[model samples]
Target: MMVWTNILVPVLGTASDAQPLSVAKALAAPFDATISVVFASPSASGLFNWAYEGGFGVTDVAVAAIQEETERGRARCGELLTALDYPKTSFETVTADDWLGLRSATRLADVVVWERSAAGGHGFFASAFQQILLDERRPAFIADRPPDVGGTIAVAWDGGREASRALRRSVPLLKKADRVVLLTVPHAMARPCDGARAVLYLDDQGVRASTDVVHTHGDASPAILDAVRKMDANILVAGAFGHPRLQRFIFGGTTQYLLESLVRPALFLSH
Candidate 1:
């Protein structure tokens, strides 16, 4: 029997209580045994201490203090997790200077967890993990309000590299769907690419897929959401694009819009 590898979600010591806590509960609710949790413990800060010591040579002392702080921070994260979540499941720590946490724990996960919007700003140390983790092309599930993922599954496709990546990640979950709807809002006056590439890619891997391109007027998010409700989709899937701005002022980006309005549980992968 092919064991459906449970889950691999990335946790930053910085996640909000609701999202982090919710993710933990979701994992433990159905498949705790097959799950492995990871907390990307990047240094979060440069190693250095500048306390005016006996003399002007305070760099070394400051560096030592920083290292101590980082190590302690890592330890504290593990200490903070719920006891039953993953008692023996080792939490991989990726130090700040590396791919996520110094080591790559992504390979051990089938699905990755991410927040719809970033929770930090300038001077934040762990924020880089967002782009890094998303670029890893792992299936990333983002949380929104309302939490409607236990029912209909809606998939957004444009067939570009972005949509292709999203489709690839969604296939694992698709197999368990009671109903799957592939909706596409093609470029204005342009024909849907038949989702040829993504469909072909999934076909090569033997994924069960079907499609429907709605010729609609307006932006992709509204149309997508309308279809989501129309198709009775509770769980939605789409490719996301996130530019690491020290601050994101995305009032018009499709991904950003959906992130802001998604009340149901949705999975989104960044390009």
Candidate 2:
């Protein structure tokens, strides 16, 4: 069976209408299977940045702007999909309700592709979404391009659950990968998790894999970029290796590091 590759775009309850169109563009950008779009509805009221910027303290104007953005976004998405020469979609919407895990008319997603918006103060929601995708065992793509183009992939293998999860999730691109590297950071934790680790796992799964042992640079972000260039990899895969705030449950070093990085497209699987 073909693995599903998903593109998740955040509508932020404002520009959600554009999500399906964005997904369609991403899907058409590559030669692949199963492209999907997703939007999350706000469960609570929050400040509308655009509305606030426009000096709209009036509730009616604020409501109108949000609805208009949502409607136009959706219609544009449909038109884009049609223009791109894809079949008419049976599914598309802006909602927060749906069992994403089940095959339903409303949910036709296998993975999520989120927009990488810059952090607004504390980026808790994006971080939460990241953790959700990891926990769900689904790949998350923070897109730089419409659809994540898969050519070369860099796998940060340290024999951990998250790293391994990233590698496993990357199976869809592996088949079409021109090159792939299993980069190992010689940190304190280099024990093998059985053939369940990376190298061995990739072999068993019939994915083209190779390995490289390197010292962990000051931080992993730049090191990852160096590896990407050295291996000519466009996509980077790694476990979410960061500290989490116990009280707030916010992400720590490595997670923040990767997200802050503009080096390459990375797939982070959380533990």
Candidate 3:
């Protein structure tokens, strides 16, 4: 079994979040893990284009700020690791013209921690959360708050391939958590016993878990959120973009709801 030893956090120079690093440190504490903080800085040409396109007029100061931001990110990373008492931390700064290089960095980690979009900003990733959800083969932890360490974990299971994969990949986290709750909602093909099987599967892996069939009247997202609150779960692990791309885009989906509505419990999403 692969332990979450190498954690990667890619920071977007435009309003980044350090909570991901904090949460990763907490998760890695037991294993004495190493965190690699990669600062994705925009190229000078990219910054020049942004300034020119935005009618701000490119200036030496503007370009210099971009360069300085990368250094600031490195300094902050070191400070945060020291504050968190995590010594096995390393920092790297990469200048990427686009999101491609950033996406590639995701592959280098056993797991990735992503910060939710910041207000009045485009967020850490230039692309949609879907891009990371789909592109990264590893589990992506997206959260607005620091995830509760060793607290209750709520798994949103819908009996879909995406949900199953999320559950399977969640074992490492599950092992770390104090309790696991398998949360399921009604669907066309979903059987009540389905959640039970998930419970049994977790039991096989020595994860203490129970299943709850949450009843919801309207949009399932609210119900899912309700379940998380009622259970007081620290993290909500679920599948992302489960619907077909076109369908999900046209008519929003559960992942979209969780991202938009719930802000307390951190989201651990996978596809």
Write down the lDDT of every candidate, Cα atoms only. 0.54, 0.52, 0.70
Per-residue lDDT value at 149 in model 3? 61
Q: Which stretches in model 1 have alpha-carbon errors above 4 Å?
A: 1-6, 14-18, 24-33, 42-45, 49-76, 83-88, 98-103, 119-130, 145-150, 186-191, 194-213, 241-253, 262-265
Error of 1 at 59 (Å): 7.1
On a 0 to 100 scale, what is the lDDT of residue 51 in model 2? Answer: 48
What lDDT score goes with residue 252 in model 2?
Answer: 14
Candidate topping lDDT: 3
Candidate 1 to truth, TM = 0.68
Candidate 3 lDDT for residue 25: 77
- Candidate 3: lDDT of 91? 72
Better of 2 and 3 by lDDT: 3
lDDT of 2 by residue, 96-185 (tens): 333342223223455555545521114424554544453454555554544344577777766655666667766766656677787765
On lDDT, the stronger of 1 and 2 is 1
lDDT of 3 by residue, 1-271 (tens): 6467777777653334457777777766776778877777778888788878888787888779867876776677666656666789877777766566666766767677776662112454636344656766567776665666689999888777777888898888898899899877764234444587788888898788988877665666677778889888999887766556423410124455566773468877777
Clashing pairs in 3: none
Residue pairs whose backbone atoms clash in candidate 2: 7-113, 8-112, 8-113, 17-73, 17-74, 18-73, 21-77
**Prediction 2 TM-score vs. true:** 0.68
RMSD of each: 5.5, 6.0, 3.5
Q: Candidate 2, after superposition: displacement of residue 16 in Å?
A: 10
